[model samples]
Structures are given as C-alpha cells and as structure tokens.
Target: MDSERDELLHTFVAEAHEILDEIERALLQLETGRDVYDVLQRVFRATHTLKGSAGSVGLGGLSDLGHAAEDVIEALCRGDLPLTTPVVSLLLETVDAARRLVAEVERGQVERSTSHQEVIARLQEARRGGPAEPQGAWATSARRATEDDAEGATSIKSIRVAVEKLDRMADLIGELTLGRNRIVRTLRAVRGEAGAALRDEMEEQDRLCRELEEAVRAARMVPVGPWFRHYERTVRDLAHAHGRLARLVVVHGDVEVDTAVVERFRDALTHLLRNAICHGIEAPEARRAAGKDPCGTITLHAAHERGGIALRISDDGAGMRRERIAARVRALGRHPAPDALPDHELFGLVFEPGFSTATESSHLAGRGMGMDVVRRRVESIQGTIRIESREGHGTSLLIQLPLTLATIEGLSVGIGDERYVIPLRAVLACCDLPRGSLAHGGAQGLMVRRGRALPCVRLRALFGLGGSPPPDERVVIVALDGFEAGLVVDSLDGEGRTVVKPLGQLFRRVPGISGSTILGDGSVAMILDVDALLGGVVRDAVPADALDERRSAPSAAGGSPG
Candidate 1:
C-alpha cells in the first residue's frame, strides 16, 4: 500500500508541474489580452487539478494552498475581485508556492511551513478586504455551508499521466525506423506487375506512419493565448512604474502553437514587450509635445503569414534613433562610420551582444541582453526575425516562423536525382521560364522575369547536385520581406504536405537546406530555406530592381489613392 501511494504521489507531482506551466501561461495571457473569461477558466482548471491531486497525495499543506488559490480564481471569475495588480501579484506568489511544494513532493517530503498559511491569509484578506468575522452563529453557518458544498462531489473518472510517457511513446515510434527500412527493401524486391501493387501498399503504410507522427506531435502542443495575458499585466505595471500611460492591444488571441515553442518563447516575448513600453514608447508629455495623442499605444499582433506565424510588436513611440545606436556601435569598436549604414543595418545593431543604446541601465532596458537573447531564441526555432522602423513614426518587429516545427507544406522540386521541398507558404508561384528568357549578368547572376529582373539562383548549383540546367527548367518565385527571387529547378513535381524532420549535426551547417522530409515514395526530400537562398543570391550579386512592378499590381478600386 505504501509503494502504491508513493507511485501515486510521483504521478501527482508530474501532473502538478504541467498544470503549473498552464497556470503561468494563462496568467501571462491575462496580463496582455482581454480574454478574462478564457483566462479565468484555464486558471481555475489548473488550480483545481493541483488541489485535487494534492489532497489525494496527503499533502495537506499543498492542498490548502491550492484551495486558497482556487478560491481567489473563483472570486475573480464571479467578478467579486477584479484582476487588479494586487490580485495578480497574489496569484503569482501562489504559483511560486505551488512550485516549491511540488519540488518538496518530488523530494519525498512535505513542507509544513507557514508561508502557505501566510499567503492564504493574505489572499483571503485581499478578497474580503479585512479579517474574518468572529466564530459566531453567522460564521458557523457559513462554515457549514462551505463544508456541505465541498461534500457534494463526483467520483474521479480519469488519471493524469506524466508528459514523459508521451515522450517515450514518441521515442518508440521513432525506433520503428528499422522496420521501415525492411519494408522499403521488401517493396523494392517485388518484381514485374507485383511491384505496382506492392508500391501502393507501401504508400498506404507511409501515410499511416505520417499520420501517427503528426498525432504524437499534436499531443505536445499547448495553446499560446494564455501566455499573452501575463504580458498585459507587465505592460500595465511598466507603464505605471515609468510614469507613462500605455495601453496593450492584442490583435489575435485565438491562434495556437506548440507548447514547447510557447514555453521557449515566453520570456523572449515578455522582454520584447517590456522593451517596447520602456524605450519604444514616449511618455504622455512627450507625446503631447510631438502633437501625437497623449496616450501611447503598443500593439501585439499575431497572424498566419506565408507558411509560418508572424508576430508583430509595434509601438507608436519615438522610432529608433540611428545616431544613438551608431554612437554605441563606435563605442564598441564595431563600426565607426554610422552614416553609411542603412536603416535596416543600423537597427540590426540592437541584437548585437552587450550593445545598448540606453545611456543608463533601468529596470526595463539597458541590460544589453534583451534583444540579443530575443534573436537567439527566435532563431533557435528555425525562425527569421526582421525589424522595420521609421524615425519619428514607430518601430515594427516582424517575426516569421514555420507553421509547425514537425510538419511543413511542401512543393517538391527536383535537381537531377535529388529532390527538395520548397515550403508551399514561401512559394509565390511557379512560372515557365523559356530558354530565350534567361539572361546571365554581373553580381546579380541571371535575371528571368521581364519588368524587374529577379536575381535567379540555380537550385542544382546551390545544392551541389551535378547537373546542367534543364532545357525546360522552371522558376519558383519566392517573396520574403518585400524581396523577390526565382529559384531555377530542373523539374517541378506537384505539391503535398510533408512531415519535416531534423537533419543530423553533420549537415546542419549546409547552406540553402533547412531540414529534410520523407516523400510518399519514401525518398528523402530536402526542405529549402527560401530566405537563405534568396539572401545568398542577393548578397553575391547587385541588387535586382525591386520586384514591386512584377507583383500583380493592386486593383485601383479599393487601393490607396495615387
């Protein structure tokens, strides 16, 4: 019985950690966005989960803390106590206590410390605005009512499993690689007309394998909307602390992303939003001086862009000061001639390690690691980051990320025997390029289109596939950040959604390819990084005339006035 109890306790601890993450994410979301109803539901669920699990494990102190948190969340849901700073602070402290308790449980001990009681008392006071009434008739009646409410319970239906179990399942599925190889060999060995039937069966198996992989990946996803709330609170406090009136505006809240990615990007997003409030926005007085509205506006918007999620953080504060950044760059001995640097390059300096434009370190800015860390975290997920700033107008950060780390929609292209996957989101269109239309030139290499000659890079040459350009090779036009380029492929196959898998460390440094995927035919197809491919082409050649003219010109009816 003791062994069984120990096993249950271990399961409780693991499940509690997952709930804590959800609670943290929900709190963050409440801070940034106005999804009070959804945030309250998630917070309540997490606390309720913890409370039940703690009680079952005989951790009375932990269960009591969970009960106190549950009460506060309930009150918040009922609109009894609004989500004020003091309330949010109390909730954050509650989360911290829950975390410490979980850790104690992991160590096979229970902490009977007064910290839990103190927090519970504070939360109760905050909720009631004073101490409880004496143990009179009214109090006894209220206690009896609460006890009756607690006793009207339902039977437990399900058990919470550790995420590690799912992870282990994924590993076991991954080890089916050897079986896949044997199946492939068997299919290839079938002769004559039997080969076609065998190939069909293999394709079916492949589809099932891909579906299984996607399901395993989906189990790991947690919604990102909850995490946006905490930033709302952060923005509010930072505004008050800095003597500025700032409002946080969230554009899209219903969108979801992988849980691990959300967890990884949480701090980076918070730091970015904090920087926007502190350095990106002007104070109320400064806004009035500039003839702008006195109340500063900071917008956090996310949407599906290309094949990935684009989160744009923009502020109507004073845009980046090139002169200040240039001075810092010189001070750091990196570049002395700031005058020659373009706006993009100048703004890029913010991500340079230990480089800060702020004269002094404040609580919010000038630690010098904010933007640098932001860049690292975004890039760690194979995402791209860019900044567009207009002096005196505002600064907008554009982050382009793949829709999912585990899967991608791909347009397969072939270079000789080698196949590559061009993310369908990145592929603008595929057009036939006649042999007569090819024009080779200076640094910009060959230009294919007519009006604005786009820099063209041969896919075969880029990937070192030994083949001459095909007579009827087509061009895959990909546009990124307003830059358009055409990739010349030997052959264009149709499109399909492909499950992307990481290439080992040996080939990680290889240019042009981001990752690899297995095709329906069981052939490995390399996934192309359109940005990198176009970047390399542009970097080696003279910049092509902006491709804006070639773009299907906007219709005049709903378009901006000429």
Candidate 2:
C-alpha cells in the first residue's frame, strides 16, 4: 500500500509541474488584458489539485504551501485585490516555492523550512495589501532546500527521453518499408495464375501496414502550446525587469508540432521574445514621449503558410536603428556605408555573432549572444529567419520552418549524374533555359522575370559536374530572403515527401547541401540549402542585367520544367 501511494505521489508531482507551467503562462497573459477571472481560476485549479494530492499523500509541508497559494488565487479570482506587478511577481515566486515543495514530497522528505514559511507569508501578504518580500532571498533558499531534500524518492516520470528513440523508430519504419518492397517484388516474380490471388492479398496487407505506420507516427506528435507557454513568463519577467509595460500576445497556441521540433525551437523562441522585450519595446515614459501607447504590445503569432509553419514576433516599439548597426559593422571592418545598405540587410546584422544594439550589457540581453544563437539553432533544423524593421514604427521577425523535421517535400534535380533535392516549399517555379542565354563565367548571371531581375546559377558549374550544359537544361527559380534566383539543372523529377537523413560527418562542411533524403526508388538525393545557394550567388557579385536577360528568354524546350 505504501509503495502504491508513493507511485501515485510521483504521478501527482509530474502532473503538477505540467499544470504549473500552464498557470504561469496564464498569469503572463493576464498581464496583457486577459480576463482576471479566467487567469485566477486556472491558477486556483492547479494549486487546488496540488494541495489535494499532497495532503492525500501525507505531505503536510506541500499541502500547506499549496493551500496558501490557492488562497491567493481564489482572492484574485474574487477581485479582492487587483493583479498588480508586485502581486504577480509574488505569485510567480509562490509557484516556484510550491514546485520545490512538490519536489521535496517526491523525495519523501518534507522540510518545514524558512523559505516555505516566507512563501506562505507572501501569499498571505498579497491577501492583505502588503508588498512582496525580496524574491532573491527566497529563490536562493528554495534551491538550497530542494538540494537538501534530495533522497531515494525521485519522480522518474519526469525522466528525459533520448533522441535516439525517435531515430531508431524512424530506422525501423524504414526497414519495414524495405520489407514491404521486397514482398511486392516477390509477388511480381511469382510464376502462376494461382499467384494472382496471393498478390492481391499482399497488396491489401501493404495498405494496412502503411496505415498502421502512419498512425504510430501521428501518436508521437505533441502540441507546441505547452512549450510556447514558457515564453510568456520569460517576456513578462524581462519586461518587468526593464521597466517596460510590454505585453506578449500568442496565436495558434493549439498548433501541434513534432516533439523534437518543439524541444529544438524552445530556446530559439525564448531568445527571440527576450530580444523583442529588451531591445524592441521601449519604456512607458519613452513610449509616451514618442506619441505611442505607454503600454507596448509584442505579438507572437504562428500559423501554417505555404506548407510550412510561419512564426512572427512583432513589437510596436522603437525599430532597428540602422545607423548604430552600420557603425558597429564599420567597427568590425565589414562595411561603413549605412545608407547604402538595404533595410532588410541592415536588420539582419543583429544575427551576426557578437553583435548587439545595446549600448551596455544588461542582465537581459546585452551580452550579444541572443540573435546569433537564434540564427544558429534555426539553421540547425534547416529553417530560415527573416527580419523587417521600420525606422520609427517597429520591428518584426518572420521565421519559416517546415512542418516536420523528419520528412519534407522536395523537387529532385539532376546535376550531372548526381541527384539533389530542392525543398519544394523553396522552389517558386521551374522552367527550361536556352543554352545560348546562360552566361559562362566565375559569377553566375541573373534572369529577369515579371519585370524583376532574378539571379541565375548553373547547377552543373556550381556542383562541378565537369560536363557541357545540357541544351534543354532546366532553371529552377528559388526564392530566399526576398531575392529570386535560378539554378540550371539537367532534368526535373516529380515532387514527393521524402524522409531527410543526416549526412555523415565528412559531408557536414559541404557547401549548399543541408542534408540527404532517400527516394522511393532507394536512390539517395542531396537536399539543397536554398539560402546558402542563393546567398552564394549574391556574394559572387552576379550582374543584374544578365539575370534579366535569362529570365526574359523563352525556354528552348517549350514549357515549364516541373
């Protein structure tokens, strides 16, 4: 009976942490015009559950703290006290204390420590009209108490799963697919009229097996909302620390993404939201002086766009200061002409390593590691980030990423005998090009389409195919960072979603290749890094007129390539 009770307590602790995360997110949203009743009700419910479960398990210390926290939430729900900054801060502190108490209970050691008493006092104080006690002292004591209480009792339910599990599952699925392929091949080779019925049965088995595999994959997906909630608290705390009345608004909170992608994107989203609060939103007084609302708004919205997930973080505060960025770039000996640089390029400078707009270091984000880390992490997942800023209006960051990390739709292209896959989402259009129009030089030329000049790169030359360009070669126009460019290839295969597998360590530094995917025919296709490829074209100083002429010329092979 004791063992069963302990197991139940462990489950409570794990579930309580999940609930606490949701409550913290709600409180953050409450700071930004959310209904007080709704937020308080959620906070109360989480605390109530903790209190009930802890008491049932004879955890007096946890039960006491949980009840106190619940009391404060109930009062806030009743409108007994306004949800002021100090109150919200104290509530956040109380949530932390409760979390520690739950951890102590999970360890089977309940400490009647001073930190727990302080949390009770603060909760009661908020019930009255007193300001919260210093949070720093409470934080230190809570950590120490949790450390002291570490024991044989651990919540194993919270154990981290290895990424290799997902990898192994994917590999197993691949093998199963190969098995199905072999069965089909055998069915086709069977030599009798009686084998026809057997082949039909094999086809039915294949369909059910494929459906089962897809269902299992779908079960692994977790909603991204829980991960998205953490950013709300981060934004709230950063805004308060900086004396800015910044409100974070989130959209598509219910969107489901793969668990691996969610885990990978969590830090990137944190850095982006922190940057929006610390660098984008100005102080209330400054906002008033600038003739804008004193309470700044930072909106974080996510949705599906063009077969990918688009997340945009926008702030209605002071926008990017190009002159300051240009000055920094000049100091680094990169460029000195701020006025000559485009707005998008100037805003992109923030992502450069060791670059920051902050005049001095702060606890928030002045160390210059924020945007650079964001860029690297996003790139690690084969995603792209873009920035748009107006001088005085505001700044917005647009991040476009595939829906899944495991598989992506790709357009297969042949460069010599080597095959490469361009993410179909990245390919704007494909057309055949005349051999006479493509200029041959170190720098690829541009093509003009719809009155816009688009750069053109011969895929054969770029990949060093070491053969003459095909007379009926195709040009795949890809759009990246607001620029369109074309890659000349020998042929275009059909588009399909292929599971992308990472290349070996030797190919890690290979230019213009993000990863590789295996096709239905069991052939390996290299996935092109459209950003890197187009960036290469721009860096080579390709002439604009040549790009214009290539785009205007009719394809010698008649219609669109794919």
The model with the greatest lDDT is 2
Q: Estimate each model's TM-score.
A: 0.66, 0.83
Candidate 2 lowest-lDDT run of ten:
150-159
CA lDDT, every model vs. true structure: 0.69, 0.72
| Model 2: per-residue Cα lDDT over 259-302, one tens digit each | 66666776677677777777889999999999998888888788
Candidate 2's C-alpha runs over 4 A off are 18-46, 70-83, 104-115, 121-131, 135-163, 182-187, 290-293, 326-333, 438-455, 465-471, 537-561
Per-residue lDDT over 404-437 for candidate 1, one digit per residue giving the tens place of the 0 to 100 score: 6666678898878888898876677787765554
Which residue runs does candidate 1 get wrong by more than 4 Å?
1-95, 112-207, 230-251, 281-299, 314-355, 387-396, 432-444, 536-538, 541-562
- Whole-model lDDT, candidate 1? 0.69
Q: Please report the TM-score between candidate 2 and the true structure.
A: 0.83
Clashing pairs in 2: 446-547, 447-547, 447-551, 448-547, 448-548
